[model samples]
Structures are given as C-alpha cells and as structure tokens.
Target: MNNKSITAFTLLTATLLFSLIAHADIINTNTTGRNTFSHRLSNLYIPEAVGGETWFDDQNQYNKLDIVASGTAAYADITVAGTVVGTTAEGANIYATDNSGIGIAYELNYSTPGATSPQYAYVYPNKLTFNGSGYSLNGYMHLKYALVRLTQFVPAGPITQLPTVTVNYHNLGASGYPDLSVVTLQGISAQPQITACNINAPGSITLPPVNGNSLVEGAQGITDAPQITLTNCPGAINNIIYDFAATYYNTHSYVNGIFTTKQGDGYAKNVYIQLQDATGTGIHINSPLTLPGYTGSGNYAIPNFRIAYFIDSGTLNTVTAGKVETAIDFTVIYN
Candidate 1:
C-alpha cells in the first residue's frame, strides 16, 4: 500500500484502541428490523438528521432516529426503545407520532433528559398529527396525545360513555324516537357541538356546544318545533317573560305526516308552565313538568292539545321557572 494509505490506516486503528480504553461501557449495535433499533449509538450531536436510516453507533448513547416511509400517507409509528442496564433504576416508556404515529426530532436525543433516574428503558412522547384523506405530509404535524385503546385498562364486559342527541318539546309520541316537526327545530343555540352520534368524542372532527337561544317564527299548524324559554338564566331563581294565548283553536288535523289546523278553527296556542327549580310561587313539584298531549290525531284525537289558552299567570317564577316558555314535540324520521 502507498505510504499515505498505510499511515491513515495506522491512525484509525490507534483511535479505535484509544476509544475502547476511554469508554469501556460502550455497548454493541446491530441493524434491527423495521422500526426496531437495538444498537447502542455512540453519543454525538446531530445537526439535521433525516429518517429511514440507522443513526446509532455502538454504545447506544445519543442516536438520531430518522424514521420515514415511502409516501406521506404510509401510516407508521416511529417507535424507539431503551432498556436500563441494571436494577437500580426504573423502566420508562415514551412514544411520539403523526397520523398513525410518526414523529420528528430536534437535535439528537436517545432518552428523556432527567425524567426517570437511571432510566431503564428510553423512548419519550414526541407524537404529531398529519393531514389525512389524500393529503400529503405537506409538513403538518400537531403535537398531540394519541389515546391508546383501553384494552390494557378496562374490564371485559364493556364500558361506554354515551353522548346523547336530545330534543325536549311538546306532544312527543308516548314511546318512540323523537321527531322534529314544524312546531319544529329551526336551529339549536348549540347545534354543531351538541349533535353527536358516537361517544369517544368528536375525534379529528368535533361538535360545538349549543349555548344561547333566539326565537324563530313558525305559527303554522305544523307542530314539531323547539320550546323557547325566554330569559337570561344566571345564578338561580326565575321570572316570567311572556304569557301565551291558546284558547282560540277548535281542532287540528295531522294530514299524512303533518299537523294542519283548519283555517280559523278553534285550535289554541298556549305555553306550558313548570317550576324548573324552586323560584316560582307555590311551585310544589320540583321536577313536575306540564306536558301537552297531542290529540290532533288517532289517540291524540282526545286532548288534541293542552296548555292551550294557557296563561303565564306568574305561577312560573321559581328556580324551576323561567320567562316565556313553549315546546314542540315530534319524531326524528330516519329515511
């Protein structure tokens, strides 16, 4: 070999021998299978490392794990693991990701700094979010906590937190799904948020909570609508806002699936008064509510409707009472 080559080889051998003497604790390394990095990388500072390759040396000290897939949509979790050498310390588990679980690294880091003493295993939470549905990475990753399915926690049978879609109105069919008639739901004070179909939460997409309310104009004989309670409910107590007039209507008819009152008939329109709390005078029932029966059809032909010709009469001013009150009951027809 040339003199320069021989000299360079001698220098490299000398450096390796010196390193072995200095850091005798350095462990061996290997190219573990996909996502698995079992090598003990020698400690070092990484300027700008990328993924899809092994960045560890032998000691597993400071390894730069650059994990990536062929395309942005290829879901894969960039997982790393570290095991403590002896019994004095506890084991730690940390993970990070994007979409299905991919993460980024800032400077080279092999474990959580000063988190667990004598960290038995290494891997910290460095998860990120991704743009799904035909969208490439485009460099969008939100730091988030990915929920690990509760299989490791909960008991067998099954536990579920139910979120409900409810509508409280008047004249709901005795025991069937609710309906939204013209006495109907215009818009909820909190629609987008309060309308949920499943439970775990509106993941990825969320529902906005319904808060305040304003009235809509719909006096047609069609009876499915919301009950508007007028007033700003604060601490407690209540006050009557409006008294409704319901004595004028004779009778109404539900044609096909709609509530239609005969023109100039005696069908009435009145508000139901209930002591929502204990604020109103002489409100004896705490939870007793005034429900108007629908006699405008079949069995409903009897009472047709109550609370008609009803007056606020100031009897609804308790913690249970509010201002002006009205209700619309119907069914949610699923086509």
Candidate 2:
C-alpha cells in the first residue's frame, strides 16, 4: 500500500477509538434532540374507614388512595401533575399498561426558570408526544405502590401511625444530568382506633331464657329478640364487621359451627348461641365480612348487631336452665 493511504487509515482508526471511549460513559439520557425530559412523584394517601388518611390496609385491599405530584422541580421551572388509579383486575402489585382499567395520569410541563404557566409537555405512562414525535405503552413512566400485608393486629390507640416510605427513581449517570429525583410518602394515620368496651357496655350481650316450651313452639328456635348495639362509637367508626372465635361450647347444637356454653355454677343449661346479622342471616365466624364504607356526614352512629340463643334439644335429652353463659373472643374488622 502507498504511504499516503496507510497514513489516512491510521488516522481514521484513532478517531473511531476516541469516539467510543467518550460515549462509554453514557448510561441513560432523558434528553433527545433539542427537547429534554424529567419526572416527579407523589405520595399515595390511604385513608382509614373512620376518618383521616392511612398508609396500611389490613385486608390487603386499598381503595381510598390518592396521588398528586409534589410540584417541586430540581432543574428549571417544571410543573408535573396528574391522577393515578390502581385496580385489582390485573391482580395486586401490577400497574396497567393501557388507560382502560385503573391507573394515574401525570403531565410534565417544561418552561423557563420560575415561569408561571407553561405548556403541557408530556403525558406519562400513557402517551408521550413531543416535537412531532409520539410514543405510547411506555412502562417506565408508570407509578406503583407495594403494600406489605400486615399479619398481626395493630395496637389499639387513638390513632395508629405508620412509618414513612421513601421512593427513589434512579441515580444520575456520569454527565450529572439530574435524575428523576426522589419522592417520599409521609406516614399515614388512622383515627378513632379500636379499643375494648366497658363491661356493662352495649357490645356485651345477655340472652333470655330458652326452654322446652320455646323450642317446641318455634321451628327456628328464636330470633334476635333483643337487638345488640355497639355504643359509644365515634363518627369516625362508621362501618364495622364482627368475627367470633370460640374454643369451648356445648355440643348440643351448632350456630354456623360455633357452640354455646353455660359457664359458672348453678343449673347450667346445655345450649348454644345463634349469631346473626341485623337481617337475621347467619354469619360464618371464620370468613370475614366487610360492611359498607362510611357514608354519613358529621358524627357517625353506634353500630347495631343481632343474635339469638336456643336450647339444643337435638343433641341433649333434657335442658337444664340456670346460668347460660359463655365467652367468645371477637375481632373487630375496621375498613
């Protein structure tokens, strides 16, 4: 080969090597052509059934969460805002790709430093339209909240507060091109926490006498003759559900597989208690039942319940009546 041609080839190889070394530092870039991109995140506030906001859901299902942008930008005057919706349709911990089911939509607006009103620039997690360039179905822009299921019961207090969680995007690459900073979800607080009731309160129940005459006369034994109510409930404790866990009871009859026992001395009767909702329908003690969310305004009301007691003539030959008492450990399910 000629000396001039060899020199040109050597120069070309050197230039190519330099270019590769410079570009090696480029990890991720939000900037494309003349336009640049950025992002901001918001906290998800899950309010309790009583009142105020909360960050935890004991039932593993959250429906009252809302998201909003922090409106604070690190580079220039950028405004980000939008709504995000979460659904159980695609199962938990999964964000939807399309705008169809449930997801939040956020918009980022880029402008001069301290600009008051800027034009909307990008629609995140949905459609990104810029400089005659449009892109859809981008999963990188979606937001997600991973709720760890609570195994144990929360302690009873005036309010139960959870620790705050910080969410970071990604670190900035070599160029120091500001990465989509980090956002934090402030702690959540549940109001009017659950507590034990007084001994003579409405939550306690005492049944009337059940004898052979009553059992022979009626087929369903007895209905909730005297309605039971949960009194001293604040307006915050709007809706509630009850679950009973009983260990020992007479085997004469079964109320949804739950037996009733006659504790203490003095002519204890072999009977059982029948628990029911206000509608007189038997509720299973194992499975949980969710009542309607609170819809009332101002102060909430005391929740009312129903139950009936009957002598299990089907199991025992004779029914002895004296002190028909039993104990049941109940769990209060708050939405």
**Each candidate: RMSD to true structure?**
26.6, 17.3
How well does candidate 1 match the true structure in TM-score terms? Answer: 0.16
Taking all chains together, each candidate's TM-score versus the true structure is 0.16, 0.37
Cα lDDT tens digits, model 2, 209-300, are: 55555554112444443333343332223355555566555333334534567666784555556666666665566555543434321222
Give lDDT tens digits, candidate 1, residues 1-335. Answer: 65664444444444444442211111111211112122111232111122222222223222221222222221112232322121111112322211111121211222323221222222332222211222111121111111111111111111111111111111112312222211111111210001111111111211122112322222111221123321111110011112222223221222111121223233223323221112212222211233233111111111122121122334222212122222323221101
Q: Report clash pairs, candidate 2.
A: 83-104, 83-105, 84-104, 85-103, 85-104, 235-300
Off by over 4 Å in 2: 1-78, 83-201, 210-242, 247-258, 278-281, 293-305
lDDT of 2 at 115: 21
Q: Clashes in each model (backbone N, CA, C under 3 Å)?
A: 57, 6
What C-alpha lDDT values do all the predictions have? 0.20, 0.34
Per-residue error (Å), model 1, residue 263: 2.8
Model 1: CA > 4 A from native: 1-123, 127-142, 147-335
